[model samples]
Target: MTFACGKRLFALIMSPFYFFQSRRRRLKRQKWRKRLRRALFPFLLSLPPTVWGNVNDFALIEGVRIQPPAAAVLSPGTSQPNHPSPIHPLPPLELTAGRVLLQRYGCTTCHQFGKSTPAPTPGPALDAIAHKVSPTWLAAWLEDPFTYLPASRMPRVVLTPTERREIAAFLLGLSPGWRLPSRPDLPPDPYRGSDLFDALRCQQCHRVGGEGGLRGPALDRLGTKTSRRWLYAFLKAPHIAQPGTPSHSFHLVDQDALDLCEFLVRRAPSGAELPDDFTFSEQDTILAHRGLRIAIERGCFQCHAVRSLRGPSLPMPAAASTADSWLDHHRATGETILQFHFLPTARLAMHRALQDTTSIPNPVALPSDFWKLPIPPQGSTPEAYSPENRDLAPEACASCHVRQWEEWRNSRHARSLSPGLLGQLVDEENPGFIQHCLTCHAPLSEQYRTVTDGDFTPDHGITCAGCHVRAHRYFGPAKPDRRLTASRFTGGQHGDAVRTPAFRQSEFCAPCHQSDLAGLAFDGKLLQNTHGEWAASPHSAREETCQSCHMPDGQHFMTGIHDQVTVSRALDLEIDWKLSPETRHLRATVRIHNRGAGHHVPTYVTPAIFVKVALGDERGGVIDGTLQTRIVQRRIQLFENRELFDTRIPAGGAWLFEFASQLPAHAQLLTVVVEVDPDHFYRSFFEQYPSDSVQSASLIQQAHAQILDSPYILFVRTITLE
Candidate 1:
């Protein structure tokens, strides 16, 4: 064979091998690109759409974008589709179904919601019901609201036929002299009204025939519930017809309002008739008086506003009923329109209401026999000593423990039965209610008037005997020195003290400072959860207890949210600012850290911490529209029985409040103020009890004034700028 022929054969075989190697390399490059694209896909999507102009035109796979021609390009400053602003993210406002129920049922009248004051009473004022609706409609509604409007928040109220008639008569008789004016000009136009309803988007907030938003009441039975004239008046000017109504006036022409009213009223189910004209008569006077009695008995005034009826004065006939009985009645009979039986916590709240007791549960766990007075020491006569000595009053204890008594005297515990509490209990005739309050406020048996026959003085609030004295023996924490024994103490007249290590544990304080009832919790958090909060914190692992901080060094002064020094110590605040010369704007950031405390800075719902920032002129006055405020606290809607927001900083957690605004031409300084309100909830609660509405008006007024005086500035800082 020739040399040239052999060379040509080898070259052909090598050419095929080289082609396979090139193909493998190309395939490897494609795999790498695919992996890289996958890694960048999420990061690209997270970027603003403007980052990749006309994002919709491109199909993004992994990190690569494949776009077709004709895709629009978005340039800087060009208008874009409306999207949520991303400058700063805010916590979402949480509203629960439970809260809606509470508001609908008029529970907010007595209970508050969030940091704001309690909202106006939910139920309509009954003073003008006679002039507003037909007597037949009123009776039917009072008897069974669900039958008329299936989505009604008004509870069934368990009224009998006679009771319903009487209640209707009483309400109708409220405005006996006034009558609804006839409006003959407005005529029926159901078809036009239906069109107007759709144009107005009425279903956005209201429901008709069980389809629409739940913001407003269902209009399914409006025809049977209200007259044509009344409905037209309401549609024309909702605010004027029913002040504070959530319904808004559409500024419609008279004819349009008439049409809309007709359309809404026509939504009634088949066979339903329109409400007829109503006239009040002298015979209603007798029925009204009886109705008033039943209304008071049934706690109707608790939620509904009636000008003729004052706050409930008569004691509840079932005041002696136990919590279980109250719960059972609500569960079995369905007296509550909301059907509280399904919610154990709600049922418990109803029980508390029936008992006229505060929603706060007993804090401390006491023995069954804890309230019983101890038997006098052997041979000690019942009348041998003064009442103070016999009862082991605080004054007697102060004689021996001067420092501790002095500290405690200035503490909140000493004023547990302050004017606020006393005012509520002053007109309260239910002994059970009073007793439940005294269980924590004035725990000693001797302090209870019912038990001691007025022997106890109200001034001696939480007496020393309440915590230390039991069975005529002194009880307290064990001595720090393990070597010391009870035998070492000399028994003079008072006898040797009984010591236990349990007093040093946090559990000892759990009874009063913690609520163990799951039903009482909102958002899975107890109303008073200091102990639980501490348990979840790192301090608990380090063996820190409530006494370690609140009662440091065995001090009787239990300093808490009210003490400026203590609160300041628990929190760490920092303020930083940066001035942008380009935009002539100043950005300031204020950070608050719950650094020292084992739990939340303000551990209970009662206290609120506010951080306020604003621009100030040379005179130190805040500039208009330049102020910003942030609150750090657990905000609850008492009536709604739900937590609206919990901005409270947990242990070791930090909350940031950022402010960015253009520097005003005359701005000279930046000021920040931090204020603490120890009685925020109490202030709102006290303000709700109007002088004319409640029996203990004077006391409530005094309480309101006292609570108003409780807020104090915690921190203030000012920075100067040229």
Candidate 2:
């Protein structure tokens, strides 16, 4: 028994060694067979008549003998035959070639078809896109690529139709069959549907849900709220109808109209919805004082009339609504009716109405005791207030120009009459001068002619009839129909009724702006001659209108030459610095030159210029600093917004300065910064409208330095600092 057990143990111990030996022998035999086959196969294939081949044509080296090809080898199609089938299939070759083409074209640079590695995504991925796109789509896309994406960065690939088909087949094979979500296919006829919607008077304030007016919900995303069939049946027409009320009204239409119902369906998450009925309120009403001011300040009258307090009453509402269509229709038709009638007070009244309803809170408050404030009355109301009969008070016609009224509510002009800027210029010690400047600056209607200590209001700035007066004879841009007509009213406020295109003419502005500099009774004394200065300029001599450069496209978005865009282009301040031991100072020399503008070097459009200097430690904390400036146009009134000044910088001009500061004791690095004013000196302050002519003048300008081996060594940087 002991001998048998020992035998079993011995066998178990040798089994592993035998297994390893067997594997090694098998590997060795495979390697030998491979080598032997390579060596003998060619010789065996060529063994047709090697022994008898011509001995003179063969050569012998050492113990190996060789024979010429003609004597030893078999010819093609003779002994060894060619195979009938190809070694590899064609599909794999085509796929490999297509992939190579994709790489060569750089398609993978921005797009990742199905990459395993993560990379920054430059555009949307096309993973499994084959399931979504049809084969025909791929062909058409390759043919005319631009039709798919107007802003495509993809360059056109010159692939043959066959290659495109192969690629398309490969992509389509990714998913055996993919189906579109179950939704009824709808025709794309949005324009026709829009016309039908309008014809049906559906837009009479009712929105479809999401595709409709802002006043109501546009119904395009209605699937979450209602079912498709319900919508379809509703369109077919509901039996019960409500009058005046929206739900009671019939919303159903014919089969063709029901086609739009498909667009109403959509996918949604749990409990998704639009604003409920409880959210609608007067707050939604937009009272744009900007629009109103454009009408009044630009002189909407002379060619147009409204329901006036004086003269013939024209058609206009007592108050204005914020509805877009209402304003549009009024503007479109108002001019036609104004030519034959006069409406003056309507504009003023409308202005009052807008002030009460607008939501954008006014920062400046109107005085509660306006009647008690010391106010100066006008010499005479413009003739628009004069009635054919003398017994009635002259009615201000501004009461009817609702659009202009709303705009004035938000304008700085509305606050002009407040006892603020111009009023402060009035020497409280001398009330006579206050009354004197009041005539042109804050002219009241003939009906409200009186000077007192208790009747002040915001009606002091440039008012109606100031621009609409007869001499200006203003007309807005010509309508599509170019027929000209004369106003029917007799001459009074709006100058003599005349058939002229004065609105389009520049001379209309000369009256107020070009007023005689020396004798003008404005600002309690002659104010600086701005209009006179402009008139004397070459720009005026060349017949350039103020609106040409100041108001591009006649927009009120006032901008100035010193704005960031203009400044960046005009002045490039290349700053250089060096540390001088003798002076113990870090000196910075700024080389500023105007590059692409036509104005002066430093024209004064606004009042101030500031230069700031700072000495800082390498850690970026300031050690010492100070600022300097020249206030060119100082405020004449105490109440001016942000210290009013009129400063302008000429085009194509440069202003340069040098700053020096002591270096910190342990400074390792230094930084320099030169930035322009944040207010855009000229733009944000003075003009009612300014253009974006300056761009480089951002609020912050900075530069940095690193300490090298030597403290004095430096690198000069040339960039737009401010």
Candidate 3:
């Protein structure tokens, strides 16, 4: 702990770098020359004992190998009342006495059975203690350890049997699962952690599992050595002046902290090797320090911070000093530094240097964005659409938006030509329909051959890469390069190569949804008009694009209660419900409070949402028939000559519907189910007749009818409907 010792320690830390460099420089003078034997021996001996174990497997890691339990100093059974004596008792048993003694002496500092790890190598691991020592010896050791073991390191204590027993029972009952009594809850989505990682660009220096730059530790599994709370605190605020310095205090937000902790804990080695607090040799420490310096010298900290700057600005370098002031300010205060940045070349150089220093990885030049494998430009007129020329899609997007892809897998856009509503129109019944569908549905480049017969590829329908990647430009379906449109086509590649830019913007989704295909016709007119509807709305006039409303806050999954709230606010009707009691039966009423739905609650479509009441007991035993009633029951006609069964109440008009059902006399609860059908549709007039020529009329009708019969339910409240 002296300044000299600190400097020596720091020197030891820097030795690994110097050792390798010294050896290399000496090698240039003499072929395969070894170091001066004595000098090299001390340097080698200077290594941390743990590193020696790492290299030779001979040196033992201190405090790791199990030692004999603290010698049996106290008589058995007297430690606590409930802890029966393993041997004859010499004193009275009590738990409170042990508790008092422990609290009075601050024994909890190093021996936390729960969430804290006070100091490394402070004492023995006490995760499960009944298996480690006898209750009698534990009590005696707590009271006066020097009594039995002359060289006992533990201090003597004075406490009654009650106080001693209390502490003893607490310690003896310790289990690995012990944690603080109160712990905060975590959010469902750990997306914040992923965002933090990207914001910090941790991969720039730390190589995790052979990937990423190796300027820092290969934290393939870090959770094994650290706690989640510690990591979370460290990510945001690094311990600059503390003993650990900048290594262990990178503070993280709650979610990111938890998620990263989960990720690391999952990476812990399968089998335990060394004890948690085992000390390392001086050599290992030196190597680590040298490695850290190398990382810094190569500017690995530019993008990846072992200690990130969370405040305002990037960390500034140490200021130049005058000639006479080298030792003037030994205690000079360092300015708070924010962050660092590295150029592509510098990053690559550091990567190479670290690999050479560690003998871990051979540097290989990779594309700037490794997620999307780069392709070279080829000489061609119309951009060739070969698999080789196309850019591989970036996987980084998936890292942030995994749940969105899962939902899109079965969407209409994903399966535009696979026997769904759109695909039915492209079957052999109409051979030319495939070409027409592909214009908007598949959105492929013109270089690909046109469809002449029934055909499909994994890339046939709207896929992630197809929509996101395009030639020359990104976002929206721009016209293909004109060079390929010539009559005598030269199948050469052009500058227009598939590039991913749409993933960053809303305009990317507009081309297919907004414009009409060249050939398709619906009843001698245009077909689907989602884009048209969106554009014509007031939102479009106000510069609100399709994604703004549908995908609130740029989330991958573009559907939620917010959309319902937005649309519901625009319309006048607000559907609210409650239950009424009547004898043993209960009446559930749905009251529509019209606020602002431009049309009606169930307008332009037929949706069946009703109030259903059911009586059940604690064991979920049904006792009565379910009573069901619908607001727009049995398709009643209203205004505008529309199939008014699904009527639109005036902007401010209200409607009330009710259902009554008997409850079990012994029932404590009755369930009232109220739902909203987001995907409801009225049978079009054409669909009501057999003459309608829409290709999937029957299938569409079947899907529509099933939905009408059983719509998606919404809120379910179990009031004392009994």
Candidate 4:
């Protein structure tokens, strides 16, 4: 046959196959389009009418309208302008929503957005991807994370089928020679796993079938997406799979892990299978290389750690740049809106995710003149009274309540404006930032330097007046008799005390202790979750509160982890020792229980407890190398916005530390020391503030030194076994 005829014959033969591929691609696109519309329709409908006005003037993508730069995005409590101007319009909802979306998705991790330093990327490190998940699951996850986990913060990057397979190959190929452990022959008991789950209090952080906490991913259909083998491995040691995962290591036995895997896997719908069309070959170096390039080009490295590629840090957004400018820049480059085919869906998803995760309420509005105390009520202020009585000061209150003042003086509330905080504020030019810190540190309006009130005492830090006096009237918890009245003599001095039950409620303290900043959260948990922690505990149901223990007997001492006695009372330690005389070996098992604390023991990330076991000589010291230590704390890398691990014992939970070692000669004693560092995280944070880097260097140095001295031995027990 002629060459031309051969070419024609080949083309005819491949036409049907090409047509089938084209049809499949078109159907896939249609499916996603419908899904996006379904997800976004209700969100768009709920927006204010103003947002939909002049829809023809805005960009239309897949039947949804994107608001123009002139359109205003009104949050709750925001009102529309009475008379809108054509030349200078209100800032678009797009800009506001866009900035929020950027932060929520961790865009600032690689790209500069504003004056604030970029937070660490919140993505889990992928070093052990091979062991954590099957290649099929990884490909499906990379293709569209929302399919498997709707609440995931990861944005779907548009990629072809080949690209998806390549990316999966690249990630799975990270540890080329890695292999999964052999599965046990015996079947696991799901019933036992269910009991173990409850015992571990997994519901405290994770959800199942839409009925648990939002701190971790929902496990409703986990079995369908992952294999029992992978689940068992993950349950055994979550950190080994994903180093920065917020999931705690429960140190489960092999049988327990197997049973938990069985229980979780049983949750999948009966006939469901792992989602993927093609198998990925980790040995395909060419495909992996291509995938790495695609990952880098698509900015996957920005949020995720791609071992083969290192993304460069972009320049910070200009100091003068506003949110509007930032959005405009991204829009101009088509990076934020046009690059992603489902931008509308992503935006709507972001709104939903935030609503689900954010636990804190909106900021309460204060009176316009809230900074100044109201004019002393009609006849309450007497000219016969001295300045001490009229002035809004802790010392004035101390004149009558001497004992409470003495306790408050030595409390953390008194030292709220610690050198560490003050040092950082010294160089902070933003008034909003300063106010945010002082909101909890020195809560009184008069304590603000800008208040211009004569009673401004910034150094007093959470004075008695801050909590008890407002609008020149005294307020406190209702007396046991429920009487709102004060004595006839004292009533004239500070006005009739306004007795309210709110003063005794946990919600009263939530404002400062619980935070909901989307940018600061890890695994959907707030940075400071003490109030949230208490709310989830049995204490909240029983009406026990932060004040119950911290301020026992209405004492002003606000005792916390810093108080050695308080900490010792919260934790119960038990140690078991086994010595092998023939082998000259010692094995120690120590367990620490959070029995008293209403919240997690060492609740916040600031404190860490070290459980150490070491072999000691007759002199009580000279053993060379037989020490083992386990830390109990929430370890987080703040700058990277990643949580390495959370070993903090939850209320009523316990942690086990096992140590085994061959004893050296002359090791006559075994010592176990449990040390508590109240300022563990702060020590590292403050150490970064060098003299040349900040204006308050001396203060920072002093703060570091103080933290170094804050650690104290919580428990020490020596077992002599010569």
Per-model TM against the reference: 0.46, 0.34, 0.34, 0.46
The TM-score measured for candidate 4 stands at 0.46
Candidate 4, 1-722: lDDT as tens digits: 01111112222332332223244465564454346445543444344444332122332334445543454322111244323212222122323333334433334333542233333444666666666676667767877776776556666677998898887777767772345677777678999999999999999888887688988878877765676776776786675544555557568878888988899888886665556456655456778776665775565644555342323333333233332343344344331232222255345433332222211111122222222221122224323223554576677666446568778988889888677777765654434334445655676544656432223343477777767765444556665543422111111123234455566777566545654322135566655677768877888888998888888777899999999999998898898998898998888889998888888887888799998888898999948778888899898754345689999988878999988888887888988899999988777566644332344787788788877778899999899985
Model 3: per-residue Cα lDDT over 575-605, one tens digit each? 3334345456555555555443322344323
Taken over the whole model, the C-alpha lDDT of each candidate is 0.59, 0.34, 0.36, 0.60
The per-prediction CA RMSD against the true structure, in angstroms, equals 32.2, 45.2, 33.9, 33.9
lDDT of 3: 0.36
Model 1 weakest lDDT span, ten residues long: 87-96
**Backbone N/Cα/C clashes per model:** 8, 79, 47, 2
| Residue-wise C-alpha lDDT for candidate 1, range 1-722, written one tens digit per residue | 11111112222222322233244465564454345434444443454333333212343242245542442232112344323222221111111222222323333333332233322343577776765677778876776766776546566676887787777777767862344445558566989989888888889987876699988877777767677776777776676566667557458777787778778777768976434434457865767776765775554654576654432222332264653553454245332222233355444433343333211111123332332222112223222122333556677665435567778888888888776777655644334335445656676545655333534454567768777766554456665442123122111123233455556777666545554332145667656667778888988889988888888888988988998898888888899998887877999999998888988878888889989999999999999999999998898865455799999989889989999999988898999899999998787566653222253677678778877767899889999975
- RMSD after Cα superposition, model 2: 45.2
How are the candidates ranked when ordered by lDDT, highest leading?
4, 1, 3, 2
In model 1, what lDDT does residue 11 have?
Answer: 25
Global lDDT of model 2: 0.34
Clash list (residue pairs), candidate 1: 37-62, 37-63, 38-62, 155-337, 363-511, 363-512, 364-511, 364-512
